[model samples]
Target: MQHFSLHTHTIGFDGQNTVEEMVKQAKKLRWSRIGIANHFIVHPDIKKATFYAYACKGNYQNIYSENFEEALFKFFPLFQEIKRIEQITQFPIYKGMEVDFFDTTQWKGDFYRIINLLKPDYLIGSVHFVDYKGHLLNTHDMKKASFMEQKEILKIYWKNVRSAIKFKAFDFMAHLDLPAKVGLGYGKEWEKEEEETIALLAACGGKAEVNTSALRQKDEAYPSNRILKLLAKYEIPVVLSDDAHSVSQMGQYFEKGTELMKNAGIKRSIYPIMIADHIRQRIYMDWHFMRVR
Candidate 1:
């Protein structure tokens, strides 16, 4: 079967592989398309001096101090190279960012500006942090919060997702159940919130991704089988994303994810790309496009 993976990161972020090495691996896997959706730089306060010092501390430290513009400049050449390879190899490569979305009420401006400037072919919206008294509470920290507080944090995250969809800032919602993956320990309560969130996504004309990263964590894909069924009930399209941080992980666990989706009765999904504005308009209006298929 033909395969495509849209959520991958290379050395541009915390990923372990280079873009070329990733391409080679994807080719080995016979993937028809692979998108390099690295984490875009979000903070610019750290220069090379501070960045190296921060990296010395550990991966987690560097995660929060990413220099967005510097990362973009570093990755642009690799992106161009990937485009060149596509010309010869005909293996599709898409450019996009896995943007870290904090609460929209607080951090929306920066994300909005970056999206407008990049105009990426695809974008994945993810909530990696929650706000707490001017401090950034990551998912790791969020797990320690009280049950009520955890619910509030998830509610804010879902709210931010809704805003992202309303703004049309992303093509897919990445790792829809990221909070769950962190072992928030909310148990069944999260399901109710998920139901509401899935309904909201459907209303906003947005799609949710079934990220295979969770498979590596020894869990089923995010938005578990139950949530996937709820999404199907709401008619919210489901896309399978690997969230691959290495080339070998491209299209990884896709078979299992597709099987889960099939079991849930989800039959169709959408993949985003850069097309002419006229064509985009027609597609937006539900016009048939033989080429898109």
Candidate 2:
């Protein structure tokens, strides 16, 4: 029985429900607390991204930003409303962001600074976009890209996931095997990379999640059974998340998630205490004097 969820989105980003509506649903489930992790998609090249130009309907103008300071300012209203709701309902609501992990020194520097100032309760590291041949591609839009482009992007996508973990900018990883959604996750070419990622998480004392949303969208959960089994072998800390995008999605189908975890040999789940402390104590970035904590 999972008591909480930290992976959720609301109207401000790409979700259907309001914060108040989500909280109302949470009350019905009688959760201890929940985190509202809206998409924090501030990419320098997002304005130039060409994916889903015709395949998808989202304009994505308000959703992406190149300016970190402005983005932080824009998030203020959402956080304020969360605070108000917490006080009124006496329910614990943690401020969080489902960040799109970018593997650049500038991006990291800006991210670290903004997070320090925002002081969000938690952050989820995710790679929903991959830079492919000068154009940024959304992972979910994989079906729209050319076969050759998809092949190369899949390669880059896994590397980006690795970089995000090595960067240590967020609390835990999200949708570890997300590409499987588009029929590319369990490929022979990337199996070695998947093994390395699992080993990397264990070596770092890092945490991960069994995202229940995958079950809703597909036949299985994110971070699939094989990954979960390896996580158990490594004794890595795990959390179960609905990854809810609406009121109906909150704390739903956890029983199925638990069953998957059980089958995967994950005996227990953890409440992680550390954030951004990498696979190897600290990231060895380019700057010689810049010690990132």
Candidate 3:
């Protein structure tokens, strides 16, 4: 099985490992490439960071101001360090961010500004929260919610996901069926909407990710077999990710992910480095200029 992983996290955000440690683990695992994707600016409407903090029993409200610049500045160095590490190791290390795309209407302006500035090697758009009448219902916090509430959350979550793709801020949609992974909802009743969502994602340049993290939860990998088949049928590209939070999880379960893809009859999958091809082009342009000089 091919070995690589793009959806990983480190200490710059909530991840358990540091960049150096994660890289070391990747090398130990004999991975050809590993992309470090840290959490970027969360949407104000979703308030993900704050919610996560509260859920974890920590104080996150004061970590930054209303503007979010302070939190961003704090995290910027991690990206710089990732670039430096790539230079030294000569191994493929991509700079990426996992942005919460909960409500495009509310966060489109912030999302565009941050994405333009970062110019990340890639972006993983994920919907972590759903808006219900102005209140945000976090998927991770569903243990406290009612069954009806969870169903409504999934409905709005998919709607926001569609909006996120339309915004075109990410290279791939992270965990397309994330709501279903938690067993919050999504069955036959949602099949039509799922088809529509996949169609919309394909219409845009965005693709879906086959996230393996769901397996740890005893759930089928994100974008289950049925969804993967739909994506393949529509000719939508799919990327595989471990969504690893620690070094040990780097490239975790990729063999299974690839097997799932094969069973879906998907002959090809996108490697994360494909997103950095543009940078390679620019480097070539610079070299040509030097030769002319």
Candidate 4:
């Protein structure tokens, strides 16, 4: 049995614990591997987006900078600290970033440039906001309004998700049915959209995270049982993520999470290990391989 957590957060973003605290806690909990995947967003338009502003702190402009350079400038110190902690702890802490996917018209060029420059151990593609006309609307806010009225917005959300998959810039997809955060289902009419998204993910050599964080909100782990069944049908790979924001949350409820994966009919998980020359090759290995590293 392998013990590792691939998705986590620290004080650099919205998390409660610092990098050092997270690593030490994981060690105490006897975790073999962990990844610090803080938010690495550079959406300049968040300042005007009501939902985003409120969610990210309305008055704080420094959090989401206008360009990648400025955002990296503020983020570099935390990145360096994570590397330092990895050396000190000698833990298998991989560098990761939970990146937001935006449409090409919005900031495609910047997105490509940032990924090329940062080159994290892995990139977790997530869609929290959907492009409405020219404005970026938070998907979670859609629940605040009637589903009938937000039908078009929801459609566009899935559409953009397909586009994100086509971009093929990420290694894994996070919270596949994220719009469901609002408790709205895709219905039979949108089943095609769901299937297409899952197929694209499989075709792109992408994996989905069985995120347990949703349980904290009293919701099922993302991708729902229906979506997970589809993933299983398509033979798509899956991984476990705590999506932890604090020390106490690391691997929280993972026992139940593994049960969810088993019920979904998923068997193996992929772990990316870097070889000489720093190239990340997705190698399916057991716990002993990870421990000896």
Candidate 5:
């Protein structure tokens, strides 16, 4: 087993369990370490989003913020919880955020403020929303959409993911093919964006994770075997994450995730902070390091 998960969630966010409950499960499993990476999604127009998926009941718990400055205040307690947990146990538990990527100049400015203030132990960039014909579309809505509209969204989604990778702020990117589970990214129309994203990941020396959460729903992981092979071709290092929303899901199928990495020919799992070996420069501040290990 990998013995650690740098990407998992709990009740403070949209997850089903409390941080203490999740940590207790890890202790019982005797895991080497754990990372509490709840969602940190914010968008100036999120509340006014055209998509119905974003209006779900748990948006508040999931940390969905329409204003940047207000979101920072909300993050205070989540970070504080990490310190509180540390007092009760000596086991390693890192503080992290699975941030949704947005490319607007204003958004970037606010995002930089988050890094400067929150000071999370790590960040995982993700793309859960896409712009389609001037309307914001949630990838979770693809399952019900007509194929014609879905086709256009897939292109934007994959390119959105590339933009996130090129940004180079996260230790790793989450669920490269997030739409695959919803059944939208398998066509050849978006292959160029997908290929470009993989190439950009290799060039940027960014990291990706084999998210085991998808396997529990379908036979595939987030990147899928096809993309996993592509990541191997680029020699991008990988890590396993449960994307756990509950205690039982903490390490759900990590053994399988590791095997998938091995079969895909990925050779690195970020154990000693060796990301600088070939990741090149990421334009990050001295304090905000790239620690994929």
Candidate 6:
């Protein structure tokens, strides 16, 4: 059936399964392709993000932030492992990373340079934090909310999303309605921001994923009906993701996720092949990159 998934995690980061285990499960599921996208964030204040999402339970500083060069060094071997597995199994495995979008002004180093160096097959850009005038608003941590108004926090979330889209560093936007992770909704006040975000994604030839992980967490698909409908209205490409962290979770609830997406007006599924082709074309044409400064 040409089943494939581009958003998956492994022990390379926060996932439960190892790369080998994930591939074996994909083969059993009869998937035509599988992409391993473990977490690879870049932020100067990442150490300050003490929440579980960013902290990795005190392992973050040692594993990720301790040595930027060494941390990046650790990732290439995993890609090589993916390549080795591909050679043995002859299964299509695309190398990808789930990148954290931090405000550039607070960035400690050149993220774009690091991305180019990693040279993954593709990237999934996500904003787990909203840098509001220096204070961080974590999407996963609602208690630390510095904003007095809920809508204000929502607005910054969309603005950070806009910044990610404008940067054009990612193949697709992951979890378009991520604030929903913490019970935040796209309120009426965010209408203009939502519309403009969709427009920017469409203009950038970008796509968003109907992340099914939300089903497990929030009982809804990401990009919700409101955003998904606009994605359809704008004719923006959409893909589905299991956001799988374990072998069992691979393609978990995807049938329902696809149905949810179809109901939301998505007509096609963007697979890894399409993402690779898009990357190739962008490189060949030397597409103008918009760096968020």
| Candidate 4 error regions (>4 Å) | 56-63, 278-293
Worst 10 residues of 4 by lDDT: 284-293
Please give the CA lDDT of all the candidate structures. 0.68, 0.78, 0.71, 0.74, 0.78, 0.74
lDDT winner between candidates 1 and 5? 5
**Local accuracy of candidate 4 as per-residue lDDT tens digits, 1-293:** 34677788777577888888888888898887788888776777775776655756643334555668876786677778878999998987777888878776657887777666666677788887876766667766667656574788778878878777888877778888887777766577768889988988888866777888888885478878878888778877777788998998988877777777678777666666655443564422222112111
Please give the distance, in angstroms, between residue 71's alpha carbon in candidate 6 and its true position after superposition: 3.5
Candidate 5 collision pairs: 270-293
Model 1, C-alpha of 227: deviation from truth (Å): 1.3
The number of residue pairs in model 4 that clash at the backbone is 0
Pairs that clash in candidate 4: none
- lDDT (10s digit) by residue, model 2, range 1-293: 76778899888677888899888888889887788998888887776676535323664355577779768976788899999999999987888888998887888889889987787877889988887776777766675777787777888888888888887666778989888877776766777888898888877656788899888776678988878888778877777889887889898778898888888888777553323447756322110111111
lDDT of 5 by residue, 1-293 (tens): 57778788877568888778878889998887788888788887776675535446545434678776777876788788877987888766777889999888888888998778887778899998986666667767666678887877787787788889889998899999999878777766666777789999999988888999998988778888889988889878777889988888888987788788778777667642312334654322112222222
**How far out, in Å, is residue 183 in model 4?**
0.6
TM-score preference between candidates 1 and 6, better one: 6
Off by over 4 Å in 5: 50-62, 272-293
Candidate 6 local lDDT, residue 14: 74
Clashes of each: 1, 0, 0, 0, 1, 0
Candidate 1 total steric clashes: 1
Look at candidate 5 and tell me the lDDT of residue 292.
27
lDDT of 1 by residue, 139-250 (tens): 7767777878887887776665565666666667887777777776347766776787788788887778888888887647886887888877997766778888876677
List, residue by residue over 100-123, the lDDT tens digit for candidate 3: 764545456665676566666767
**Could you give candidate 6's per-residue lDDT for residues 1-293 as a string of tens digits?**
12678899877577878788889999999987898988776555556654534556544333345334655876888899999998998888888888777656545256766766877888888887776666555665553565575667777788888888988878889998788777776567666788899999999988888888888865578877888888878978777788998998888878777777667776665554433256545431111221111
Question: Every model's Cα RMSD, please?
Answer: 4.6, 7.2, 6.2, 3.9, 4.7, 5.6
lDDT of 5: 0.78
lDDT of 3 at 107: 58
Better of 1 and 3 by lDDT: 3
TM-score of 4: 0.88
lDDT of 4: 0.74
